[model samples]
Target chain A: MSEAVSALNGQSFVGIVKIEEAGPQGMITLRGDAGAAALQKAARDVAGVDMPGIRGIAAAGDRAIAWMSPDEWLILLPHAQAHEGVATLRTALAGTHHLAENVSDARALFRVTGEPARLREVLAKLAPADLHPDRFGTGEMRRTRLAQVPAAIWLDSAGEARVICFRSVASYVFDLLSVAAAPGSEVGFFDA
Target chain B: MLILECPCCGVLADETELAPGGEAHLKRFGPGASDDEFEGYLFMRENPRGVHFERWRHVNGCGKWFHAARDTSTLEVFGTYPAQTTEPPRDIRDRISARRPGWTWREFA
Candidate 1:
C-alpha cells in the first residue's frame, strides 16, 4: 500500500479562526436505513456512539456516527481501524441489503475553532444552513454546499466545527475558510 | 429565493441548496411505448401559471429526492412530500384545492 497522508498534509491557516486540516481520519459511508434498529446497533457497537437521529451526530472519544440522510449514516473512527470497521459492520448486517464503504481516503476533513459565534460566522458565510446559535448548535450536522462544493459541517462544540469535503476540493474549501475568517470579515450575527 | 421543505429530512432548505429535477410524477415510457407518449414524457412539461407539482433534490441537505407543490407565479408553497409516492397525498391535494379553489393536477397529454 502507498504511504498515507492527509489531503492537505496538515495545512493550517490562521485568520478569524484557526483553519487546519484534520489528521488522517477514518470515515465509512453506510448506505442503509439509518432508522433500522439493526443498523443502529451495528453502528453503536462499532463506534461506541449511538446512531444519530436525523441531522444529529453522537460521538464518544475518537469514534462518532452522524446521520447524513434518511437512508445514509456516516461513521467516523481512527484511521487505522477503518477497514476493520467495515468488515465488522458487513458481518453484523449480513442479511440486510446495504452498502458500506471506506470513504476516508476519498474525503478531506478540517476544523475551524475560535468560539461558537465566530465559528458560525466563518461557516455561515458559505453554507446556506442557518448557523444561528438558536438553530444550529453542537451535535447538529448539516450536509450543505459550502461555496460550490458539497460539504458537511458538524458543530462539534461551542468553539469548534468539523468540515468535511471531497479530497479534490480541499484547497477550495481551505481557501474559502481562510477568506471568510479574515480578521475584518467577522459578522457576529449570532452573537446577538 | 424559493425555499422548499424536504419531506425526507424535514429540513426547510433554500432553493440554492436544492436541485430542481424538472417535473414530478412522470410516467416513464420505455421501449414499448408509443412515440408521442415517449416524446410527451421526455420533452413536454406543464407550464401552469398557478398550482404545480415538481421534483426537487435536497442535494445539499439529506440528499434525498422529494416532491413539492407550489404556485408558479406567487411562489406560495402548498406542501412537500417524499418522492416515493406516485401521486400527491390527499392532504397536499386538499391544501392545493383549498388554496387555488379549482386547481386539479392536469392529466399528462
Candidate 2:
C-alpha cells in the first residue's frame, strides 16, 4: 500500500486515493482509407500478423493487441518492445497508403481485476462498452467514453481487463475507480 | 436526445456523436447546377414528419459517416448504412410496410 502511494506522488489527483504503478504500454494509432489494401498488406508485412476481420480486437502474442475498424486500428504493445515494434511497422509500411503514429506516451493504463460482477458494477458507472458475451467477449476491445473520457477497454483471455485513457485524465478516472472499489476491494496499478 | 444509429459501429451512440445532414437522396438538377440546385444542396430541407431518411456522421466513434432512416413518430430506426455505399441496409423491407396517410416516402426522398 505504501509502495503504491509512493508511486503516484506528485501526479495529478483531485481526491484522496491510492495509486498503482502502471508499467509502460505502447499505443499506436493507425489511420488510412478503408480501400487501402496495400496499407493492410503493409501492416501484415510489418507485424507478420494478419489484421482481424471482425469489428473487434485481435491479439498476437503478449506483444500487441490490434483493434479493427473500417479505416483505423489502435495497436497496444508491451512497454519495452514498443519502439522496436513501431519502428518495424513504420519501416514495413513506408510509402504505403496509411499513417502510423506512435502514441505510447500519450495514454495511461489501469488494470481492473477481481470478481467479474464487481468489475462490471464499477464499470457500469461510466463505461459505454458492451460487456455482454455477444458483444465484448474475451479478446475483444472497445473504444468508448468512460465518465465522458475517451477510453479503450480490452478483456484478456483470462478475463482480466485493462482500461486505457489519456494521461491528463488518468487521475480523475482513478478517483472514480477508488470510489467504485469501496470496501473489500483489491485494486492496484500494474507496474510494467 | 436525437437517436442516431451508425452503420459501421452499430446502433449505439448518443446524438452528441452525430451531426444530422437533413434528408437523404437528393437529386442534382442542371449541368452547372442552377441557383435552385444550389438552394437544394444548401438550404432546402425535407422537414420530414414520419418515416424519413437522413445522413449522419459518426464524429466520435468509428469516424465513418453513414445514413439512417427512421420514423419520427414511432422512433423506429428502419435502416442505416455507409454513405458512399450504393445499397443501404436490406432490413428495411418489412419496416416501411405501412406508410402514414399524408406522409409519403417520396416526399422525404
Candidate topping DockQ = 1
Which pairs clash in the backbone of model 1?
none
Deviation of model 2 at B38, angstroms = 2.3
- Which digits, one per residue and each the tens of the lDDT, describe model 2 over residues A14-76? 122232436566677777765677766766654556666545676676545465457787776
CAPRI class of candidate 2: acceptable
Query: How would you encode candidate 2's per-residue C-alpha lDDT over B1-109 as one tens digit per residue?
Result: 5666676867377776566776777665656888977887677766666778778876656666788877887777776767874434445534565444444565432
| Displacement of the residue B74 alpha carbon in candidate 1, Å | 1.3
C-alpha lDDT (0 to 100) for residue A13 of candidate 1: 91
Q: Which 10 consecutive residues of model 2 chain A have the lowest summed lDDT?
A: A1-10
Sequence-dependent TM-score of model 1:
0.95
Candidate whose TM-score is highest: 1
Judged by lDDT against the true structure, how good is candidate 1? Answer: 0.89
Tens digits of per-residue lDDT for model 1 on A103-145?
A: 9999999999886788889999999888787788888888899
Once model 1 is optimally superposed onto the true structure by TM-score, how far is the C-alpha of residue B40 displaced, in angstroms?
A: 2.2
